[model samples]
Target: MVRRMFLPFYSKDRGPPRIRMQVMGTKGRRFYKIVAANQRDPRDGKHMEVLGSYVPIPGSSASSVAELRLRFSRVKFWLAANASMSLSISRLLGSAGLIPLPPPLFGWRCRGRYHELLQQQQQQHLLRESELRNFFKLPSPISTQLVERETEKPKKEDVRKIVR
Candidate 1:
């Protein structure tokens, strides 16, 4: 069985080139590649496999417009193996009806990506809260002032009065 690997901060530091569809070639020529590689590897480094190819600029007149040289079967296999495509690739495939539009990053994988995103969001929220606290000299979120009076324990005398 193929093990599912989760590299935390892989997308953050190295970016999503490996698991993503990349646009290659110089200015005059451009092509797309669906590949899977290690995050730390170079752009042209070792890849698991070349799932498919998309030639956006087919310079040759002999070739039909928008020629897509793809291994349709391999595409499905890679996707099943937990590989994800870039936004552009998703859009391209969506247009071709191969895959759905607005494809998600880290599709159908475990909660690793989601947890990372949540941590990032939480950090940002904490940072914003700290900034607000510093500016306003307000107490921490867990402070007494922030606690609801209704939820607080009633004093013994108050409880006795209620009982009476």
Candidate 2:
């Protein structure tokens, strides 16, 4: 008997099964399609089935709540079939009590360090903005009223100084 080697992404018969929420829709609005697909498949590629859909942004409705539409029976069937979920899908499932909250990520992936870095970057960006504002003798970008007033009233002296 000969053993055949198969690639997980392309191999229909091997490896752990995965189901993911595939992002779709246009620029202003976006949504997701819950799909049973190979992990290696392209974002909009082949899907075995569409379990359901989720609309992150509401479509011109007065209600503020986000919409989540699911074929409950299909979801139950897929869960019984042992399909694993993507991170985002898992979170939704967790909130619905369909599954226990997923395990916490390792220490390195924790938010503290990432947040520190983000804060540092934002401070640097703000510093740059302030520097630019000072150099141009213009109101800081943070205040919309200041920006509007500054734009409406021309700084003739400042313009002359820059030209000189």
Candidate 3:
């Protein structure tokens, strides 16, 4: 079946790459991204690698449903198998004749069924952090001045000579 996959982002010291949704390509047990047909093949589509990210140009765009549908035959085998698609990659699917094209996706939304689970996980993380803080018993972050208060009374000086 189609197991939807998310295209996570990666960043380096020099630059960063955009998110790319990928899935096990039907061609030959390879992982490839749903890319524009106009672009070069990512490879033989054998190994799991990015084909390319779907880039939407500003103002006007180049990719169209027609261009995408032309490549549908290549992807039909996978679609029949119900190969999973990523949330961000829906446009490609629509273009390729799987689902109807919708608005551009800025990010991926995991199977909505897990929203409660995600919330629980976040709450658990917060609780663990609080527990750690309480266990450590660390003082406040701000520094305070230490003042010395003298309370002991001074002894009276002996006026009489010592009887040695």
Best by TM-score: 2
Per-residue CA lDDT of candidate 1, range 58-124, in tens? Answer: 5664223376666778766656655555566566666565775553366723656677656755776
Ranking by TM-score: 2, 1, 3
Full-model lDDT for every candidate: 0.61, 0.66, 0.43
* Candidate 1 Cα lDDT to native: 0.61
TM-score of every candidate: 0.42, 0.48, 0.26
Candidate 2 residue-wise lDDT, 1-164, digit = tens? 21222232344454444668888998778878888776667778878778878776456642222766677777776676566777778866764557765655568348576666457557766877788788989864755221333356658998898899
lDDT of 3 by residue, 47-136 (tens): 233344333333454453222212455455444434345454665666554676664333424546366545755666666666666787
User: What's model 3's TM-score?
Assistant: 0.26
Best-to-worst order by lDDT is 2, 1, 3
How does residue 15 of candidate 3 score in lDDT? 26
